[model samples]
Target: MLVSIDRRCIKLLQELEKETEFVSIKSLSESLDQTRRQTQYDIYKINSLFEFDKLPPIEAKQHKGVRLMDVHREWLKDLLDQENKKEDSEYNYVLTQEERCAVIICENVLRNGFSTLDDLSEQLMVSKNTIFIDMKIVREKLKEYNIECEFISGKGYLINGEELEKRKVFMYYISSIYGLISDGMLDYLQDEDVKRHIEVLHKIEEELEVHYNKGIIEKLALMLHFSETGENTKWNFPQKTGSALVCVNIDHVCRSHVYGIIDKYMKDRSDDEKAYICIHLLAGRMNKEYYLYNETEEIFEELAEKLVGYFETLVGVTMDKRGSLIEDLTQHLSRSSYRYIYGINDGSELETIIRREAEELFNVVRKVADRFSHDIQCPIDDQEVAYLAVHFSSHMHRTSAKKYRYSSMLICDESEKKRENLKKRIEDNIPLIQIHEVLTKAEYTEAEKNKYEVVISTEVLDINDGYVLISKKFDNTDHINILNEVLQSRADEVSSLSDDLFDQIKPYIQKKQVGTVRSIVDHFFGSDQNSTLTQLLTRERVKCLGDKDVSLSWRDAVFQAAYPLLADGSINRHYIDSIILNVELYGAYFYFDNGVYLTHAKDTSGVFRSGVSVMTIPRGINFPHNKKIYILFVLASVDEKEHFGVLKEILKVCDSKEKTEWLLEAQNEDVLYKNLRMIAEKK
Candidate 1:
């Protein structure tokens, strides 16, 4: 069984990932044809012996649904890939002509960490004597560049060329290898669906993976799979190797007819008259809206510009700053939305319930959105963040890799010197490098794709379908990574994946998930308390993504929201949670002032006090929606003179709009349920 689920299987999984709460014992057993007992044992070993992951809250219960830890479907893929890669391969078996060239490139890189030999030589082959004419042809190719090929004594052979020419040589080398691998991938994934997906994933790679920012790339890819098939896949190879994401205009997606259904009954419950595009999301209501943009880029850009315009309109009232305002808001949304999401205890039961038909999920989203919007008495779509995903996908990849720490030994002596000076000055100003690094080349390669930092190079760049150049600069010294910046860049060689809505986000957020929320927050918000909250918001937003067939469980939202609050920058303190979760068994019913004053505080303990920013955490994955619990807190009160005793009851209400209005009308102590002190002191 172990062998059956061996390296190849793992590698396959790495290539194809999905969104799933946890690695299933039954799935693994059936896929690998092992006993469930053995599967369980392997999971145990993975947890206890291998320590692959911390085994996130294996027994922790979701407030309402079945709870289970979500493992990146790609994990299975990567683990399998790693295992397969670990298997032995002869460094030099019967040499294929192409593999020989790659070997030569590696050898040169080992020697100088760079290379400049261009011609494909046959001298390393055992049948070199029979291929004398091919060798002559190779020699002729080298002569065009003033390079020379000669046989050496003990070492196979050496190609003599200046170090300055290394960029071209390396470009050709990677291109050759990429062509082979890309073709191989096409063949390996012969299944029609798999091939289509791979194609889409390739476009995502072109758009988002970027200059090896592994985390974002991985998450984006995993999420893409999750979006399409409702499966979570943990993949490592593409991320580790490099990938990209195509940007998507979420608003355009939301407004499209395919996004949601036209149910006349939904009208009474809905908040908007505008056309509604629900996509795979569950937007509860009967509404309509017009949408534009045939592709992700056009749509994302349109939405971003519109969203930005709306923000601009709100400038005097909402915010004052102009520069990087969108980025700042993006960070804000990323942090503020997590309070509503959580992990489940038994994922299977929850999956069974939430494992909806596409239409069902879509309807549920509409219902949830309509209901929630009604409860809040505000259009959720009005917030700056409501359209965040749409705009975020728009310009995220417009900038490319900055050229850093990379110097090409070249023939243009003075230009090269100028480039060097530019590098130094830029480095002095933006010294955060030694990471987010790129080896971009400014020189062109006949091989069609050039992959080197162009920031320091003076070489003339040509724009083709794949010839991406990171042209945007913050100054002479600051620039985006070229790999992701040039969205339509043609590369003789680059990570290729299919482009879809999920594919775009997948490439951007894939690997970034593990600790991404914190890192991105720290970068934007730093030690500020709001940073933690901001990441929660982004998590909140992410939780709401995907096909509505699987509604955003309040369970996940609740955990995402509060889990971040417990964080204090340091990993240690962040894990310690002091809060508790509770929901009414019969549902959170409204009680007028005339209702019973509870004899016991514990009975009312599960009830949130009014005026607090109430956050509802999800129960187990399969738990019913109403059973989800919340952390209620008092946010605002009517007259400042309201007593503390009355305040406690105000925070308990789960509904925000109602909570607000209730506080507004209160006139006497009767409106105030028992205060915190009374509840604590009571029997």
Candidate 2:
């Protein structure tokens, strides 16, 4: 039997397998978005369980990080696979206060009993104040579903609501929290009727020509089981109450097939149960299959058009006409609506991958999808959003559109040196435009005014040609405005309106791909491929400070560590805050062993540029959960691939106890830099 473990431990185990090098507390904390202290506590809990179960202990690598010390990695993996094969209910989870409250309240209401705050507090092993807060949150949550949590003075508190709504809330909450099957709930499916019901479902699917997402059939079967079991309990459905639910329009043949199946196990209760199960069937269908119903065809068309429009706006290019991107999106939305309406789960696994690849488009799609969900009263999950992104991304790669390039000349009536400086400033600010020449006042000629695409002059010229007036200063808003005007006009040059949208999205989304404005524009326009990894890993971005004996608070240390990047304008305050936020939420996942903390925000929200900052402390700073860090390496990167080479170099330097110790004992910044260079060179 597998040892009982909480979700955190399970996550730790999963994360451990992915670690190429020794896993750090800071890395785990950031990835898990838990505090370092909480992460350490979880690690301790998991390690203790491992000890109790006589499993190989997770070995600490001194200053590096933690490692799965089992000699046979494959054997350890097989052991984990064995544990996963066990029933989900057999695994125990360390529930949060809210989850505990939900369980307690759900059981109490299902039993048609009242429980005082004091009773709940004692039972859940929390203070009465905590129970009070839990109840308040529960009450607020139930209100959204039109369920009421009534408090009777002498009777304590009991839930008063319609049976169907109560059961909906109950099943939704339970399934969502405990995963697909709960302990008692699993027994319902274990019975013989489950097989027959599945057969009926399969027949219905065959007739409808629609398939369901995996496990959805079981979920629907469980609903029927719940309806039958709840019949014996106080939960009762009113005949009129069924009308409030949007009825799924099953064809006559499919309806009869479903009714025939339900009649075998639930003869008298078939009417209500069949309707309830049909709602679930509708929710889980993976295809649009709108030809079966005329009314839905129009609805799906509208949804598809809206989704396509939103995607176009997001990716900034018209989709290729050859594909069924709209039809595909429509089908996904059709199925996704059920997930939203019924509160079914769509996971974030794919979203993470898509986010890393094309984050700007992901954010746009998410925002647009959210708006659509609001209109339709269905909440869009990131998983569904990611699926949409996949379709849009495919469209993006297969098609091409015309991009604008501006060519202009600067006519500055200033000295040679001043004109040169002004030209560089304009080039830095508006790199998309090619400045043909910088003409001084003495060199000015009316005949050469129209030679370039646009003319930018410091003094107002009385010419009808394309002339933009600007100040003699380096950074002038008038020049920027004139350039923006020119760029905006170039939008019409493209075949699709989305090309304009792409231009609009560039400033917002191109932070990661930027070397300079010209490079960014060229990269976007398909003239240049992406930058090389070596070019991205430049030494100008690397910063280091050494101290054999210095100490600071964890928060202060992180702020101080990030200060160099912040001061240099490589990262904004938001980036620093994001790093701190990750630590606070995820615990010390970034805190590698050996007194080094790898701190960074998971996303590029606050990054002005991709850069790395390093701070060394001999005495070390104290993080939560007894984590002492000697070195702090804060990274701010726009791209996911930013740290690959850096991490490789760092891992080599900190691979062994001897190497990490020697590095820590380095006398000066020059020595540290030399050792770091040597290690990086070896790689």
Candidate 3:
């Protein structure tokens, strides 16, 4: 009988086998980063498995620690070696719930015959019950692509959907889940056929001066190989009515390379099949420059303008680098729109990170992206929204007055795509440090280390030059470390300059005035703290008008919300009129879905300073279309950037259901202000 053991037990067994003599329990625990008790428990489990297999168990002595006998050590080594080999094979590797679901979908869609529950259970190394549950999840995922997973009693399971839709899901699963076409996936294709397909793709790339991501290359190869192996009959092509750019490019490719190459291998392939290949190529192309000189450039340019215009109106700030922003957005939309329309996921690894780090910008872009979705007649998902957020964030950083104090270099071994992504993340988060160059380990030189103030490497360096080592997955800790380094470098430079300036003027000043001169120098070089939401929306600015004796109209509620700001002279009466006029023209565009009306006008003609006022009415005020507003926030700003911090905080409150509910439940101004302060502090 084989007994099950956790990974810790396996690791402990390996450690014991490696020791030539007895090792102390403390040493063993330290090696594994666990308590002595936990290590003992793991040893017990390992011994149980060894006893079941009739092998020599680990020998532990009270004075020393633990060791494995030669016989048991050899057996354990073999067992571990086998496990390692299994792990190296994708088919034998364990899958997460999501990965299992994706594998099931891929198998059902790509396999020639129906797969039974037993087949899936054995393949995934899970129980039949787990496979059954996974199938249900697989069905729901397939439903998103308008596909269905069907089962017949004795026939097993199969997916039924439009051929193109099924292909889309299959391509997505193969590209995203498996990450590449594995050996198991290529079981049906001959090595020669696979090589031929790759050669054709390479020829196309060379002719077009464009490259696809490795994963995309594999996906296209699989598609081509399958098409040659009699899958072409089921392949259906969608109407080619959109941009002729891809088609024109494909025409050139076919004339130059594809026709000559296909004649020798896949001569029977139809034009429809070739068209399908072109569609995938268009969606998967890595470089944006390919779309720059296309005939559809003007159309994408117009769409980019509308997107930026919509974003500006929503965020209330004129973006810097308007021409560059439009051009970059056009390039992105030209390709990304196809991915959305064809249901191809670009597999952005930064989407979740970007969404979390730039929540305020993501929310604003998500709202603006609705216009793009409408234009393409396809819903833009969070991955695409995250990409848009990066663009806007880079724009925001450029337009800000914050200076980049430290020049930096990034040493990353990732692909060009990933290097650019890391560079963007660093720029977006730590604007004070500008990455001057990205180099691989081979390209990096010791002489270049002294050129940059800050050197960040994804991998550890042999020489210790005080370079900051960060993980490939750049997290908040790495962000803070880089930021601190940049700020410190700036401080050091400023301090040196200030000391020299003060010394030069010291002889001309009196002894009593010396302190004042040093203070002036320090103040001149010191950084100023930007205004925050908590500073603007103080206790005096918050109000809880619960269960009013008389109902108030929307116009009256707007006045009531702005009363605090007006009373404090933060705004004039005309500011109130501007807010009402904005509502009348834009039809409550400021009203959020979380029962909070954040009313603000772009016109700051009647504003004196930046201020925020919050008010909650339990007896909701009547607005147009009988919409009741429970919580209202009025913002008055002298300029765009001054109120931005406060708006971000307000947007965060509006984004959360729990935070909005807590504010709504507050019965008095004190409670509301306390809750608001808590939220701001948490951020």
Candidate 4:
């Protein structure tokens, strides 16, 4: 293991290890008592040692001095300890210029210790000019950590900030310079003490039947190593009171094991120590049952439900098993809160995937995080937001898979008993169709049939759409076979329609728009499909209603605005329900800067097709915060891609106050239609 390395190179290695920022060459020259060429030669020899030893190299900056990247401290310790036997070197290390400045400011300024610019230059073996440049770089980096670097005239330099921020900078630099093993760790742990502590931790793991991850192990070791040192540091425990409440409900056995270990290894343990240990246990354990603490259980549960509710509304999907989803999310956030508070980040690689695949969900999660942060009085970073997005996106994908199988409508005759029996039969025999609603004869409208693919009716219908007539006691395999056959035929028709004139217009329209275009083509050109957006736009599908306020509740308002589309079979009752629930859960998130609320849910289970319906409420309905919404547009799109043009068209009209006001106050449908055309032309 012996190697031929210069003593000065070893000295340089020790200096580089202590430096967080880059050091200048001129400073290194003065520190090492060597010429610039000699200093460069020493650095070269050190790089050779680093390469031979397979250790990370010392990296050099252009203007700033050479600094050690995130190098291995333990390896350097072994080398330095080995080198100690041969030489009595007073200049044991030569810190880079940047590292010297950080040390001078942090140790002297941060601690209120005295050191003038001349004193610092002399102590660090750097010229005053180099010290000035180093301090400038340190000032910029401190901003990222929210620490202020200030220098008062007679007072020299001072780290003026909150106590918590100061310690955060201290801890960060401590880690950066020395890696995980710090002076505190080495000083506290004897060879035997380390072995005894590891044994105790292992015993606790066996008792709890839980294994801690590498992160947890390192964190535990570090905490134990610096427990006494940390106590003396007089650090602020802002999260201590909150963390104690969170730990109140942990599993008794897990808590007991943690207590046993904490008592044995960490003497005179404080509340903060116990809470910190509890967080590590909760985060590192594989069992989800141990996620929640007792007192905060209900609080996290409710928060999880509210979050999922907002997510469902934003993503346009119904979340089943709300209880389970809530529990899981609560557990994660609870654990995450502790880490976020202490600035302990076990970074995620899936953050990019979550951001790219579910960008909208990520944005929604960020908003939720912001709101939640306001409630808890803690900042939620983008990484945490991405983590929540992944959870929501996975749940939505599962819910959508089941929903997409078959969205069906069940219609039976006047006989309640017969209708009930047929519903039961269909449920038992065919698993493909998801019956959205079961309607009686009086409530059933002919228009409703258009919303579904194949409707099972006890009475014979005159409808040309997918209609099936079954007997009263239709609980047979034959009925199932017939219903499935009808479904297959309807699917084939949809496929054919999708293929007809879609290829020509696919490039021009969005993926979600393809289905709407297909429907339009089927209506206009029959089997020979051809259609245009202008022709569709000219149709009275886009309505602008008048100011006579029909007094409606928020839920009722959503339905009323959406009723026109449902009546025409552009959307279904489920889409209407989704919009209402969306408004209920996530209030006015979709509202524009103007006095209009665009009520919409995309790719919800109930969107029969893509369409927009506009309704005006002159006597506006009061939203949650007394924000009056005068105009409401219920936008229903079955998929994500198709709605770009639709949204663009709507936004163009809504963007202008004059256009929007005129459209809302128009005397009649004809006037509104003409105004819409004019606005469309202007766009």
Candidate 5:
């Protein structure tokens, strides 16, 4: 594909603005000598480039007239500076011009084989600042040809690095920092050795201007080598790494997936970084092993210290002193396994296990470590640490947010044979969980304040408001049935709470409500069928499907279910899930956002099949708007099937397309797409 020159045109316009700050369309048109429309066309072109590339957008306050915002004034100045430099170069074609002067001098210095930056600056009659900026442009342009301008502290810049070797290094460097997140860099700390490391990085950075501009840490990773280049880019390796093997198993099942990271880390970066990051991601799913490497033990230990230090800061506690915190990682992992004892027979039936190993795999410096939360996770009864999502931080500040369950409460009845055995089972299954408490009804109160928002009860009990009743009995009903029931029950509680809360604040809402809403509600409540209609309206979307008019496949079911509710205006919070799922089943496309799907349903792929929506996709997986519609299916029980709209309702609540898409894709049928591994027992 050919690249449009919008960025260049924007650059030109910005420079024109700077030179003539009070310039009109007439002046701008005269500068380009084009039509007034063409001058405006340039501004539009500028916006498109900035919008697409995500460079700060050009903000114009006035709609009709040309204007420059306060924020853009600096950029305008820079633009004019560039234009002046260009004009100076064109008129004064000899290399004496300011912009060309430094490069010409550098070429002279390189031809002489050696000259310090001071000498070059003196020779060029410009400040070191101007010289450096000129060299900055030089280096940016040089890397395209696989050339690197080597630098020394006292010495000036020189592209004298061996051509072949430099090209390889440049490629490596580019791949490393392409999307490199800056973190883990030691600062000027209390320790001398740590300072040494930062100093080493600093000195190397000066010589590696291109790499600093890019990220050198990313280059160090070996896994993402071939991601940026086209598939035919002559660099190839064995298809899968050992870490890839490990991620394959639980990547889908894990609460937070690294697949997108893996994909992005694979394509837009270098092989080393890709592979290294993948290894880290795999270690993230420690104890729940699919692939194990020789260095798993060492790697797991390092990651632990990093996590501990991070949590200590987040939770306002000093967790552990950070040097190379590798020796006592086993102790740091709150507890190694979890056995969720279902209380139906007091949690014995759902005595399932979840394990988290690799507790102390991350190594951190104390100051850097002190900035994080060490209490990121811990396991409890019936609760398993499903995932450990890590985020990068710069120095000691949290550059990103991570979701780590600190402690999961596993509620069970106390009639088991032995407490020791149950405790052991829990420790073995849930590695990241600490022995917070083995709670029965009495113990449940003790463990009420936990990390999970809901207090998971083995059986339905009148506990606190936030207590959740998890089905301790894991009988093989249907996967969709399980999720649909759980989600709907939760939504119902939330809806009830919302209504009660609204009633409390009705006076305020009535005062604040715009005329349109007041008029509509008053009109409806005044009707004859107001009582019957109120019940239906309060329940949100009420379906009155008289009878099946035509034969329909599972593909068309969701849309069929939704069309009537939408028309009737009964499609409220409650009806969205059924509508989405019906559409997903019939149209073969799952419409969803994180547990919410209804609002995002309308943008359906008439030909929808496989898709994953994320706020940010690592591999850039986008919905194929023109692809054939896909039909989502599930082997659900009658109750779950009937209540299929429950999922759609959840999607609408989440209001996140990615979440809806993930759950929908996760809940898709194997008989239809042949990818039932997400939520199915394979025959």
Candidate 6:
């Protein structure tokens, strides 16, 4: 018989097993950090489980405390050993409330029919009341993916949503709960089907000479298996024809291996089903080479370049290694575009923390993502936006000279691959600490003490000084903890420096000027150094080609708008030509969804100074896509940071229909300039 025991009860049994003689209830309560009454209740629960298994109950005397008989002691020892083994297999670890909620969601999503409350209770080893509470959490979580958990009088709990969304929820929660592909996941799928699907994926990897992220592979396998079994027949995926970039014939080896498994479970193969499988296969691929010949590669490349350029313009920093940044963005966009098309939300677990830690950078990247999404005609969610923020943040950190104040050492007993991955994650996210070495438990003990300022260990260490204990699979909480630790260390350094500087300067400064000096210092160190719209778009830079009797050509209008900046030496003639060249090559990407047409170029060689020239043409100039451009803004930037704030204000006006209309109605230079300045200064 199976027994459900809480961690407290298990600890109580372990304490009894360790003792040769009777132990006091008070000592046991202290050991488990619970009250004596709670300890007694735990003992009662353990005794009840033993009774069900027909084992001797613990012998408890009022004064002498509690003791298990010899037979009962052996029985507990064996049971604990089995439980430990089960924990090692990740099959029966005690579930936290969050994990329980995730499990409930997975169960509801994976099951073909409704899951009864009684069955869930039995499987999770909790009462129906606990399952009910878990269902509430499950419902809220499912709502994020637009899935609904519905309950009927006798039908139990079922997940209702679009098939794609349901699959996304299933993949996300299942991957979170299990961490990686494991035989333990067979509880959600048929054992034979899972094995077969995994076999097919392995074959595909071998044939393609590529590897997929393990979690992605598992999710893909499950999706493929489910699709093959006629479980995903409700919705039809659009068939994509003609591979533009197929370095390796996907139809030969890749299709054969995948179709072999699909054919066994499914007799008929439809083009829509094939397209579905191919889309997932491409999305799950980790190797960049696999996506080289992708049909949308050229489009993604152009989009990536524009995205990086736009990000640079927004964040006020030039990305280091521009080519590498473009390549990475292209790869991410390729996979993300597929996900966007299919409504698969593969967002990071650290999205909330990333947003909080890099709020300014996140906002900047969100603007970039918004532009990228507009270009592709897709809605990019915050999670994906957060991921793009990470890329830009990491790039910015790499470009800047970061001084590591503290040294860190990693102690992990995992394989070298996992240890290196953890090391990379730590270094990538937390730039304050430099990791000196990665040592195992034995290696750490043999080495010197106090060698590193921060000691991060996968397991508990016997060090006298403080150390951070993180899981082997480092999670978001661990990332935040380490980040806080490093940030606090940096803060301490800054605080000490501030104190010393204040002490040195206090005697020379007057009290009246102290506030002013302090404010200046704060602004110097803390400000982003972005220039406002009015600061850049002065009266000299504003121009109006008032309702030309003969409407200028789009090219002439671009040159006419840029002439003011060129005349004032804010920009050279080359800058204007570059803007024209961009339009010639990219076909008016500078055009916004609003009537405002923003013209700029990344080629700063022709830019002499940072300034903006706003020109209004009441007689709109026709452009490609039949877009009539009434208001033209020529931006000349010499530095990355100075133009960001003004660009943000301009984008704000572009976002508001009323603001755009206000600018369009202005007839002369003064009216256009005044209305534009009013709109720019509104916020």
Candidate 2 structure quality by residue, lDDT tens digits, 1-683: 53456665666776776775798887777686554545676777777767676666777786688867555256446655655565454345445655665565455543456779888887665788888888887887677666678889987888777555665665555544444143332234566776666676777667656666555666555445434344333324322122222223444323544445544555545355455555555443323331133233457657778777654432223556424667655555554544554445423345444554445456557656765664454445565676676555444432234223357788887788998888775654443456788886567788777676678889777766467788776332464455545644444343244355567667766676544654455445542233332333344434344453354568877888788788888898988887777778655554555666667765567787877666667667778767787777776666543443344334434544445566667666666655555544431
Model 4, residue pairs in steric clash? 23-65, 23-97, 24-65, 249-293, 249-294, 512-642, 513-642
Candidate 6 lDDT by residue in tens digits, 1-683: 23445555666777788888889987887665554545765776788777877887899887699988988877766765765455542213457676788677665674567888899999987889998988887887676556678888898887777565565566555655553125342254446776676776676656666565445556666665554235345543322433222232334423544545544443454544544455555544324433334554587788789999877654444776688667767766765565554534433444555554555566567767766665554446666776677556545532122332358899999999999989976765454456889988888863544777678889789875437888876654576577656545544555555566666877788999887776554444332233377788878777777654335788898888888888988888888898888777655665665667877887789888888888777777787656788778888776665555456567655654446777778767778888877665542
Cα displacement (angstroms), candidate 1, residue 15, comes to 13
TM-score against truth, every candidate: 0.20, 0.41, 0.51, 0.33, 0.23, 0.49
Q: Which parts of model 3 have CA positions greater than 4 angstroms off?
A: 1-295, 397-449, 452-531, 548-551, 619-628
Better of 2 and 3 by TM-score: 3
Clash number for each model? 147, 25, 0, 7, 112, 1
**Candidate 2 ranges with C-alpha deviation above 4 Å:** 1-45, 48-56, 59-93, 101-127, 158-168, 180-247, 250-254, 268-270, 279-331, 342-567, 570-683
Which pairs clash in model 3? Answer: none
Whole-structure CA lDDT of model 6? 0.65
State the lDDT of candidate 1 residue by residue for 1-683, as single tens digits. 12122222333233224423334444545454434433443443333312334334232223221123335343454544553565532211234444454445433421322122222233343454534444444454444434566655444445665432222233333333432334342122334544454454444345433232212222222222212111122111111111111212335544554334422222322222111112212221112232121333333233333344433221101222333445433343232221111000111111111111111222222223333432222222211122232222222222122121322221122444554554543343222221222223533353423343222323445543322232223231113232222222222112222122234555567574835543444443221122121111222121111233235454343344333333322112212121212222312222122221111111222222212222322221222332322222212222222222232233222123333344333332233222222222221
**Residue 260, candidate 5: how far off, in angstroms?**
26
lDDT of 1 at 683: 17
Worst 10 contiguous positions by lDDT, candidate 1: 339-348
lDDT of each: 0.30, 0.58, 0.68, 0.57, 0.35, 0.65
| Candidate no. 2 TM-score | 0.41
Model 2: ten consecutive residues of lowest lDDT? 238-247
Name model 6 segments beyond 4 Å from true.
Answer: 1-318, 323-342, 346-382, 397-417, 424-436, 439-470, 475-504, 528-534, 548-550, 617-621, 628-630, 641-683
Q: Which model is ahead, 2 or 4, in terms of TM-score?
A: 2
TM-score for candidate 5, residues paired by index? 0.23
Go through the candidates in order and give the C-alpha RMSD of each one to the true structure. Answer: 28.7, 20.4, 13.8, 22.6, 28.5, 19.3
Model 5 clashing-pair count? 112
